[model samples]
Target: MKQAIYYAQLTKKANEYLSCLYDIAQTLVSFDDYDDAKMYLVKISQYKITDHVIKEKAMQDLINVQRILTGLEDRYEKEDDLQKKMSLAEKCADTYSCLDRNERSKYYYLKQLKHAQELNLNEDQMATIYSSLGSIYQDLKEWQLSIDYFRREMSCRIGLGIQADIE
Candidate 1:
């Protein structure tokens, strides 16, 4: 009973943190103040939540802020004053807290595919790319595509020394 109560309290606290962070993240997004928003995001990164829906939503929000920041980069590029130009450019660069983890993972996955297509991809390379593409499709809810890629990956892995296990 005590353990359950403790867990409940912990869950409540986590919810509060997420709620507050969401509010702040959304609000700061409007200020043209990337620094402050990025700081708030970093602070909120401390809590580990295993909830997939919440995590996905939070990732989407972060991606929104990042897209806005990317749009603002052009403003920095137009600045002519040397000092102001440098400062703004640096701020623009710094605003990228990190690539969306999902995007980064997908990027590498696609990169492998490109490499495989460009070069003579051995069975192991094909297997790796197939596995990556499968995971990406799965996350995107393209179940058939995911299954197809996973199967291809497994089949390629079969003849190679390293096999991809799509879970």
Candidate 2:
């Protein structure tokens, strides 16, 4: 009987912690404060009341949020270095893509592609951007746009005297 009561108490506490963690996650998104959210996630993940699964899930969410925040922060911080800025922008786009935020991914990818063009990056760099855009459009099921971007990528590779090898 004592063991059953103890288990019940533990379960109740775990449920409460899980609810609190979820509430915090929603609040973080609403507030758009990644730094604080990261800290909060870390703290929540450490709560002994929650089970391993909940803890792991919280950690994964922290990683995703951190990646997005870092990409956005780094992209703006390296304004003078167009290459670095583009790289960070690409990371941001990829992170959003992984999170299933295709609209944001497309927006950031297009923005970076424009920046790359304005800066007159090398063919290889431009080709890479075109490839990324092509893949993104393909994922979004915009078939015509995807084909056009892929063709642009092929043109870029051809200009650089390289053969496209199914990439």
Candidate 3:
């Protein structure tokens, strides 16, 4: 039965398989079996997903499960070159932020900020990091910390002769 289902999925009737997946995910999520749902999405990501509802979700979950959460993070930890490390940190932070995982977002942003400071990157780069940190803090509801970071961003802008405005 499982082999037949697998063969059907790989053949010309792939869309039939694709359309059922989102329903399966919904049922799994309702049952709080989120891990299994995510795996199903990942498994079907190889196909051209025409199902609008599941396409975006499946791709995001695929990257989140396969790369950003695991591969990129592991690479970040093992990476030695400061520039490459900073790049990975920024990518991880941005991806996590987009995924609404703000805690992990904040962590990677701080990692990027630390590397930026250690390398004595230019004011513009520092300002961007400060701004990103500020936004993360705002999302996290750490008002005081957010204000401090915005202030740092302002200072960076002023030092760079750019008119600074804080929202």
List the global CA lDDT of all models. 0.58, 0.73, 0.76
- Candidate 3 Cα outliers beyond 4 Å, as residue runs: 1-37, 40-54, 160-167
lDDT of 3: 0.76
On residues 7-126, what C-alpha lDDT tens digit does candidate 3 reach at each position?
A: 657875666677566556545544545577677776567666466666777677556644553578889999999999999999989877765678889999999999988898988888
Q: Per-residue lDDT for 1-167 in model 2, tens only?
A: 23443554576777655656545664664566767667767877777767777677677767778886766656555577777777777877877675556777898899789788878887788889989899999999999899888887887788843234344
Alpha-carbon TM-score of each model against the true structure: 0.44, 0.58, 0.66
Winner by lDDT: 3
Alpha-carbon RMSD, candidate 1: 12.0
Worst 10 residues of 3 by lDDT: 158-167
Higher-lDDT candidate of 2 and 3: 3
Highest TM-score: give the candidate number: 3
TM-score of 2: 0.58
Q: List the residue pairs that clash in candidate 1.
A: none
Q: Give one clash count per candidate, in the order shown.
A: 0, 0, 0
